[model samples]
Target: MTASDDPVLTEVTGRTGRLTLNRPRALNALTHPMVRRIAETLDAWEHDPAVRTVVLTGAGARGLCAGGDIRAVHDDIRAGGGAASAAFWRDEYRLNARIARYPKPYVAFMDGIVMGGGVGVSAHGTVRIVTERTRLAMPETGIGFVPDVGGTHLLALAPGELGTYLALTGQPVGAGDALRCGLADHFVPAGRLPDLLTALAGRDVHDVLADFVGEAPPGRLDAHRAWIDHAFAADTVEEIVDRLLGSGRPAAQEAAAALLAASPTSLKVTLAALRGAPGLGPLEAVLEQEYRVSCAALSAPDLAEGIRAQVIDKDRTPRWSPASLAEVTDDDVARFFAPPAGRPLRLATGAAPQEVPW
Candidate 1:
């Protein structure tokens, strides 16, 4: 493939080594090889003193990444019970943990449309920048999947029940709300990102950011905190919905509607995952749990069916089995936390290969 034709393009300029996701046509949706490619590049860059800071940016004006190539996972499930898809996630989640603890500064230009797998790659970095154009979410519930790639870890840490609300609704948040949720560090206007990126090659990240960073637009979460915290603090999704519906708040009722439409199994599992995250110790531990939940989802009917409705058919109407929260038994949710038939994700044992941090 020509340089521009590669899925991921890597280049070193001055002290900055940049990795550009090149599949703008797919909104740089990550493939298994693309995941491996990024991990491998980080392996090399981590030890290269010349490459002081590693930068990740997308090649398009549309977004950084849409998510993982889930249609492939759908096909993988249909053909072989999702072994290949599970393997891809195992590696992908490892990469997420690597980014969180990477010794060198790893900067992500989270300009637009960061969701699912997209959130995994950038949000973990030591330096995550969001622009006015940024739209970030962990919209996996809409696809009959639980959020993976340490998403549960980040969302669990969001203030109060904001994490629970986002986990259930799968809504995209702006740069302001992203900052509020601890998903990003600095807010640089979209117009100034090019200038900020160019300066990274020569100056320290903190110094370059000071020149371009601006106050984030006010976020909505702070205003709705009282109702959100109250409604979403319930022990179960059913109660969470009951509280939201009874709150007499338009926005909260809307969130209830969104939850009603999501896959019941996914919604329940996702809640369990989010609730369990804070106790999981670290991002690596949370990822191991997410791996089990994700692999279990492969066997569930909703995953393939969800992808079919939302992606393959573009119908946006998934007929979820177990239809409602009440039908999703405690047994059903507990199964997701169990080990998959395949090997478990073993990330926390021993020293991780790339723990050097600066």
Candidate 2:
């Protein structure tokens, strides 16, 4: 790979197959090539007797990963690579499914900001580690995209209507909240990471984690759970927003504003995805539905406009089509959920051994 297309660093260290996302400059934002490389490495190591576990981390101090490189998707749209973007999503989603179902133990070191596609890479692993500095979210609606990466599946399982609140608002939560919400399994300080990595080399995954797992910082989500569940229990985004507005609390009012600021179509479709996720059978099924939404997004003006406003122009102002929630019809949401005309997500089967399915 060239400098622009740098491969994610992969190596076999002792009994561990280690994968480090090396693109610190862009927050290790995943590329299609990077996704393919990771999947290939995992496939090779799955059956290797010497490699009993896999450890995934990022190279920088700032964060583990931010998300997918959507700036490239913006360029693709400008260059009319609608088909290319679709292919990229297809492969990325398949890799996500693979990681979730890997035969061996998988651990993720989510040290910092982990969002969108970052969650896709780490959250499905058998063990997910977060630091005090970690800030996690699936902030897709801000950019006119629905939560993909099996996010809807995981978010759907969060206690009460917390999933709907997160899906619509795209709020960042800290390590404590991450653990409280089931996004992370362990908490380790950033300073202790090196020692933790060293421990992984000589000990079992569970044993090492048990030794290093410290007291998780307190999370406010539990305190706010009642309000969140009450405000977000409505069937639609509009009703949720109305409920928040009526609550008269500053936090509730702020949440209402956040929901209003997001792309209408994204908000509507994401809510639909979250509500529908619980009924979806498995990670593969969630990914299949997400593939349809992602492919459908290529033709939607909001995805391109959202990217241009957020990434290309570096402006926070996005002019979403169907600018208001009321303008987003049920039909508009249904179009996104519908399967596309071309080939669907190709999920591999029968080649891997039995283990705990993520």
Candidate 3:
């Protein structure tokens, strides 16, 4: 591919090694090759004494990344049982884990529409910066998939039931909410980012951030926490919906509607994933579990159908197989927890967290 065609653009400026996701037309959505490229670059940069920091951003004005190229994944699923898609996720999740524990600073420009795989890449980094334009989400359920890319680990770590709330609804949150949820570290103005980028190329992040970090305007989630913590705290998705519907608040009712609109099986499985994530140990263990869940989802009917309805067909109506939360039985959700038939993603492998010297 030519320069314009390269999905991931890499360059070095002063002490910063930069990665720019280049698919502007597709909102810089990631492909398997793009995932591999990012992993390869990080591996090279970690040992390069000249590269003091690594920065990731997108080339487009639309977003940092919309997500992994799910349309490609959807097509792969339809063609041959999602073997390629599974392989893509293995590497993607590995990169997510690597980002989380990188020896050197990993700064992500979490500006504009960042979702799904977008969250995987940026949210895991050491220095995650969000601007007013940031629209961040883990919208896996809407596509009949569970949160992968170590998403459950990040969301599960969110205060109270905020993670459960975000994972179930797949709603986008702004800079304030992202910071509140521990998904991002700093908020900077969009206009100021150009100058900030200039300073970051050669200067220390702490000194550079001291000049640019400022208050994020208020977000809506903090206001609704009382009800969210209570309603989503329920043990089951059924009870969660019933509590929301019965809560008698408009936002709660709207959340109920959002949950009702998603694939029934996805909602159930997502709840199980969220509930199970807390005990799954480090990000790596949670990622390994997410891999099993994601691979299981590949063979399920809704993965492809959800993508077709929401993306390809643009009909906004997916006819989910289970049809309702009530129809998704315990066994159906349990199937996702079972060990995958293929090779598993085994990061960290039950080892204690390492203290990286960087």
TM-score order, best first, reads: 1, 3, 2
Question: In model 3, what is the error at residue 29, expressed in angstroms?
Answer: 0.7
Model 2, range 1-358, lDDT digits (tens) per residue? Answer: 6643455887787888889998999999998888889988998898798988899999878889999999998888779757778877877887787888788889999999899999999999999999999999999999989899989988998888777788889999999988888888999998888898888877779887877889878987788787799988888889989989998888899999999989999998998888888787777778888989988888898999988888889788999999999999999999998878777764544334222244
Q: Mind sharing the TM-score for model 1? A: 0.97
Q: Higher-lDDT candidate among 1 and 2?
A: 1
Candidates' C-alpha lDDT:
0.90, 0.86, 0.90
Each prediction's TM-score against the native?
0.97, 0.95, 0.97
Q: Report how far residue 120 has shifted in candidate 3, in Å.
A: 0.7
Q: Which stretches of candidate 1 lie over 4 Å from their true place?
A: 349-358
Q: Is 2 or 3 the stronger prediction by lDDT?
A: 3
| Model 3 TM-score on a 0 to 1 scale | 0.97
| Each candidate's clash count | 3, 0, 0
Backbone clashes counted, model 2: 0
lDDT of 1 by residue, 1-358 (tens): 8988999999998889899998999999999999999999998998898898999999889999999998899899999999999989988998998888887899999998999999999999989999888999999899899998899999999988988888889999999999999999999888888787789889878777788889988888889999999998999889989999999999998999999999999998998899889988878889889999999999999999999999999899999988888899999999999999978887753334332233
- Tell me model 2's lDDT, rounded to 2 decimals: 0.86
* Candidate 1 Cα deviation (angstroms), residue 296: 0.2
